[model samples]
Target: MSVSVGIYSVPLVCEAVPQIGCGCLAKPVLARLEVHPDIAEAWLHHRGDVIAIKWLRELGVDQQVGLLRAALGGDGDSQVALVAAASSSPLLATFPNPSYWYQRETVDQLSQEEAHTIAARLVQRLSQARVPLPDGTALQCDLACALQEVLVVDEAMPIEARLARLLGVARDTFQQHLGSQALSQLDAWLTPAALLPEDAG
Candidate 1:
């Protein structure tokens, strides 16, 4: 008996496949697709977004003010970091609401001098936090002072790199120290409701 090998062809189902139509291939169509709502919203929020006071009532006035200053200082990376932290944190769910952009727009209405005043208050609040710099650190300045200097006062090259060197620690370590200490201090002032975990306290 001779065995015959048979090859079967499967038909390609265009409907089942996710395909861009020919119209989408056009330059004008592709150009129009560049406007992504999510990216646009994120950009708008990052550019001088405001933190709503009612949402941030869990934090002390100074901490809230400091965060606001940080957000409004044109530090998009910092704002994005804060939003990411809040999104990931079990205790900070209600913050950074979808309407947060409107609050930021309101902040934008403030005069330049007012923005400066807010930044000054933030610096003062950070100075009061008095988080210690790493041991044998080159900088003799207070940790908060150093943070403000690198983050707000100076437009230093490679801010994180310089900050790590000043703190005598790795970049990741410096970030962790700053974030954890700041969060810890803020957590101390959070309301009981805000402190509750997703399921239980």
Candidate 2:
């Protein structure tokens, strides 16, 4: 007997991207969709409701059709599970762990270089797992370049803009509080006088 792997032959619903609340999943999914327009069209055509449920079931996950439907409809909880499934990440296992939460906070508090190191480790782990990237080589290159730009800080863009991009925040929002928050924090260390030695001549 031959075992089947891949998408099930489910009847199509409507051709439209289902709104999903998990932003993390959204990015990877969109990236994959861009590289594989056929898959994207198939997903949208199926409305994601049946697809999500069927996929989970195939994986032996005890998922509720209603919950999967809610996930496709942008429910936060269900979206998290779906994302975990897609990435082969232990997001669900760690979701309730205080230590995991603390680690995330600690990473956020680390210096840019340190955070970049952590991000690099994550990318390496993903690679080791042999998880299929959304678009393969091109998308991988784009992500690498983006990460490098954020870590190196583009001289052309203002500091606030760079920070905003790294933090995935809006430039306007980053600018609004830049003076009081980032600028003030950097004032002492980054000031020219701090870098220049006192006159000794």
Candidate 1 wrongly placed segments (more than 4 Å): 1-109, 133-177, 189-201
Evaluated against the true structure, the overall lDDT of model 2 is: 0.30
Candidate 2 local Cα displacement, residue 30, angstroms: 8.5
Best by the lDDT measure: 2
- The list of candidate 2 runs beyond 4 A from truth reads 1-21, 26-51, 55-172, 178-201
Clashing pairs in model 1, backbone N/Cα/C closer than 3 A: 50-104
Cα lDDT of candidate 1 equals: 0.29
Residue pairs in clash, model 2: none
Tens digit of per-residue lDDT, candidate 2, span 87-184: 32333333323332212122221223233332343334435545433433443344344444454331334334544464442122223333344433
State TM-scores per candidate: 0.19, 0.18
1-201, model 1: which lDDT tens digit per residue? 222111111111111111211110111211221232211211122122222222312444345344433333423333322333433343224334433222222222222222233234333433455645443232222333443333222222442354344333222233454556555553342322221122432
